[model samples]
Target: MQETHDINIIAWWGALLSTFLALVKLWELWNDRFRIDIGYNFTGAPDIGNEIFVRNLSSKPIILSYWELLYGSGKWPFRKLEEIESPGPDACDIRIDPHSSKTFTFAEENYFDWGLKTLKGRKIYMRLYVAGRRPVVKKLYG
Candidate 1:
């Protein structure tokens, strides 16, 4: 009789453990995973600085793979000003924590030769490629 009771208790514990593990897996599957958002930061005063904000709204961390900014002429037959390419591989690869935001400042110093004065009062378009996701594009005033 004791042996039968011992077997029954072992089986009961085994079933309970399996159920707990299954619930944990289900909970993980239900949450969002690997997603991010990108947008431009407008401070109204252009001379101060221009920046782009990227928010990681996912359960797991992510890396920024590539990005580019194309200045728009804001009119018919729009022309594209100097394109901003991603920095070096080490610099371009940014590790963003889950549910966090990061800001990337524009390289304003290089604009002297490229006519930063003319590029002002125009629209700028930015494209970003995050890890394991489709490319994202956004428009902002330069």
Candidate 2:
């Protein structure tokens, strides 16, 4: 009887350890998934011509301060680190909450006109920089 009780105890401990390990792995997976997801949409308007709509689809918030738009003309968004590291907010830098979206209205300004002219009949791409995350380089194709 004593030997059977020892076996039962060992089996119980083995199952408990397995369950704890599984829980730890699940927690790690959940933590790994904690990051911002970004998206974009283009809307045409009679006045603005085109609106660049940005969306944050993740469970976390995103700071646009690290964002830089590389025009198809090979224009540099910032020349140096000091320029890129925005200490304060700019027109482009805004905080986006989770599952929220931002719209740049009146995008038909000179910048948009230039963008259209430059991107005409060509592919589009973007360079994204977020703090504590790897740079996301993606090609934008419609």
**C-alpha TM-score for every candidate:** 0.52, 0.53
Model 1: which ten-residue window has the lowest total lDDT?
107-116
lDDT of 2 at 13: 100
Task: Give the clashing residue pairs of candidate 1, or none.
Answer: none
Write the residue-wise lDDT of candidate 1 on 94-121 in tens digits.
7888899888775455222224575566
lDDT at 113, model 1:
21
In model 2, residue pairs whose N, Cα or C atoms come closer than 3 Å (at least 3 residues apart or on different chains), thus clashing, are: none
TM-score, structure 2 vs. true: 0.53
Model 1 whole-model lDDT (C-alpha atoms): 0.69
Candidate 1's C-alpha runs over 4 A off are 1-34, 43-47, 72-82, 88-90, 107-122
Best by TM-score: 2
